[model samples]
Target: MQVNKRPYGYEEQTMFAIMAQILLIGFGLVNTGWTQTDFFPEETQLKTAFTNTPIEVCGRVVDQNGFPIENCIVCLTCGVATSTRADGTFILSNAIRSNQLLTVTALGFYPEIIPVELYLPTNRLAVELPPIILWPSNGNVIRFLFGGDTAFARRMLDPLERAARNEFPIENPDALISVSNPLPGTLRVVSYVKPFFLYVDYPIINFESVVTLDPSTPHWEKDYVYFTLPGSLPAIKTLNIDYVGLGNNHVYDYLESG
Candidate 1:
């Protein structure tokens, strides 16, 4: 038999080509299987499982002052709901995964809605949220009445003395003009303006007086004198005064005793 000579290294090259083809075919098969397994039914099932999983969410609701707002209705957009305790804390046991909204509602306060995104395989099933603050609601329009330099001392005492002696006429006096009364002559002095205070949502005053009964002497250094008796507290309450500004120069007229 005659032996035919082939090119140098031709057999080795042929073996390598065949092996490469086999590897390519095996890799294609593996890649196709992996793609289908990862992107099809299995992936869908995993996402569905994650979405259906329940989580616990806890948070607190408070006012602008950081005071707990009890009885606030805390709920998820998916219908899971709970009420805040006296301490303003609430918990949801079955909060669903994925993107969701957490809503907080309370009487006389603006409602708050927060977006939450929960994912799968978390180390902890419970989520603690930051404190939520709710602002007090002012209806369509808020009205405020402000007064200036409200003091019942010095010259103001003249009217009270006159009223006590029946020398000054007061209309619709709420009380007797006597020292024993809570506001004494204050009601008479404020009689004309009292109606305005009652009609507004907030009544504010520049309480230029130091409200105390320590019998402290006035600061003679200042030309103007301003001080009020503690008995005037009832007048403030009666006017529904929401704020009082004591930033004037005369606030320390009676020294620390004031």
Candidate 2:
């Protein structure tokens, strides 16, 4: 057999070419103003995935007379539960953008449910909700239900688009596509536990994506993976979420503009 040798710089040249091609593609993506809708035609009209940045939720719990309620349990229905400090303040960290419910309860205070809509604010990852007021009450029974993150983007977009087109088996399919109703695909995604949410006094979740309507580019400089959801998605309201946590590292993937 004859011995054969490769070109001295063949591998280096090939690697250089690949890098150049990658740079060109990245340049095009940055300059062409390609949004999530462009790559997925089914999402053109849906306007989903605004930002998948993480954020934090913090707030103070107080009584009607503005007294700090210590040792109060402040928690999202899905997890990240915490007890308020002596100052009646609590911080829930590592929360993502989404709609959720917050359940607050103490020994002598009546439990209260607060709806949270997590979104990316300008240059901020910590969202401080307004002070929650709790009323004094005698012995009372309450119920709560918790769930984890609910995100509809990337791989989930196609199914959502199909559900929007009435391609799924659901009652009142039209409602799934309605802007004012729960998204069909989102409902389908949670159908197994949908009944649980309905029966609970407070249903909460950790929304893992920034919700926005602004058509903006991804934070290519800082993140390899980023996602966002349209603010108009009706599923947020229809799900009857009580709290949403917006604390995460990727919250600024779209810059302050998003």
Candidate 3:
């Protein structure tokens, strides 16, 4: 180092100032490319460290033996993660499109990443190495027919009451055939009185509560009369008339029960 010899006054001070300025300029060149504005331009700040387009991923994990791996943790770089269940399945929701790297890791297995395709949904994914497999969920539709209340009727109308009572058979033949029950089985015919047994001889001209005595040809008398149904119910019809019910409730004593 050499000392500058100058008068110890303004001249010496000026010499020291000039040397100091030269040293500062040399140091600036070593540290940075000296510029008046700044050593570096203004740094660009990242407004957001994330993306807007969200991604949805679903994947299945399995062991090396080709069996499902349950309760395995799955993670991604975009702060989205989930775990596999007993069926070795996991779903990653609300992930950014930029974060296509899906990290799948299972216990006692190697961690792996996969790229998300542009048009493919992560619903069904298969991993064949270190062994991992995926499958689609099973969906099915079902149909059921609902009608008739048998148990309710059976419970309300007890067995004892059902036995003692007589129900009018389904009056609507179409209803009986279509709704009640198919009627291709054996038919039950019932009638209160047979054709020959109906009391058709009670005449209004004869004395009430007494039969007039005709000693000559009693059975040949034509004075007796009674009304019968005009013709008959269609003979082709199968009637199921119970005699027990007919014998008990007889308000018309004029009509005899067969």
Candidate 4:
């Protein structure tokens, strides 16, 4: 066999390539701070897993100072009542058996009672009652709203399947109930894989049925519609418009598909 040795230039080139890859990886890790946390347990036990239950009971609470009270005690049948946080909110759910009386009590404010109905899951109640009128003057009603995961992109929203893309794609819980509460226009969003919470004061809904004449198009079976901007924009001679709010859930989906 003849003795042979590779050129020093090739060896130096290979070493330099390996060092460059190592430096790039280190720079990436340093620039981008990412952490991994366990959201779901590895071993899901039937006892620990929550069986899907329809959320029925809902409500809110307010103090004498007219401030939303959070984490006050909400109870049924002298059972364990959930505490309200500083927002003066609580909920009693139908996960427990029905035909129970919901009682709410706090330190300085008077306690209120709510009767549980047989149709508990879909029913809404008001547990927080206003202080009884000692004098005869009407009061202003405070308004609040709640819901989440609503696709509120101000554009033509396409189907979700057209949204998810591979590589370099941009991407984007508890309660108790009260009866006769003051939550007008409040919406509760059901959580799926991506959980979200929303509380809107004035929800102006402009939802329309998706219109299509063809059956073989990309967005064939999905219901979608377009939203118009409030006012017309004056044309500029040397400017182009960029969809600034496209980072939202719906627009991001459309962009991914496009």
Query: Candidate 2 regions off by >4 Å?
Result: 1-52, 139-258
Please give the RMSD of candidate 2 to the true structure. Answer: 18.7
User: What TM-score would every model get versus the actual structure?
Assistant: 0.38, 0.38, 0.27, 0.25
lDDT of each: 0.72, 0.64, 0.38, 0.37
Q: 1-258, model 3: which lDDT tens digit per residue?
A: 999886589988999988888898877744545557633343212212223335566767876456888877777666778888888877777765552445666554544455554232333232222335432222232212221110112112132332211231222433212113322311211121122112112111111111111112212232332111111222113332112112222122123320
State the lDDT of candidate 2 residue by residue for 1-258, as single tens digits: 997987669889999988887898777743545555466666643334335456689999999899999999888756878999999999998675667778888987777778787756525778899999887764354556767655554335432333322122133434323232335666565654555576556777766554544425556565332343462356566667787766666566556765
Tens-digit per-residue lDDT, 1-258, candidate 1: 999998659889999988887798787743433333454778888777777778899999999899999999998867899999999999999877756778788998866777766654744598889999987877855767799988776445444334332122233333333334437577777764665676557879998887765534667586665555677667677788899898998788767766
C-alpha RMSD (angstroms) for model 3: 41.2
Which portions of model 4 show Cα errors greater than 4 Å? Answer: 1-56, 78-80, 118-258
Q: Predict model 4's lDDT versus the native.
A: 0.37
By TM-score, the best candidate is 2
Candidate 3, TM-score vs. the true structure?
Answer: 0.27
Clashing pairs in 3: 55-95
**How do these models rank on TM-score, best leading?**
2, 1, 3, 4
Model 2 per-residue lDDT at 77: 54
Off by over 4 Å in 3: 1-53, 118-258
lDDT of 4 at 99: 58
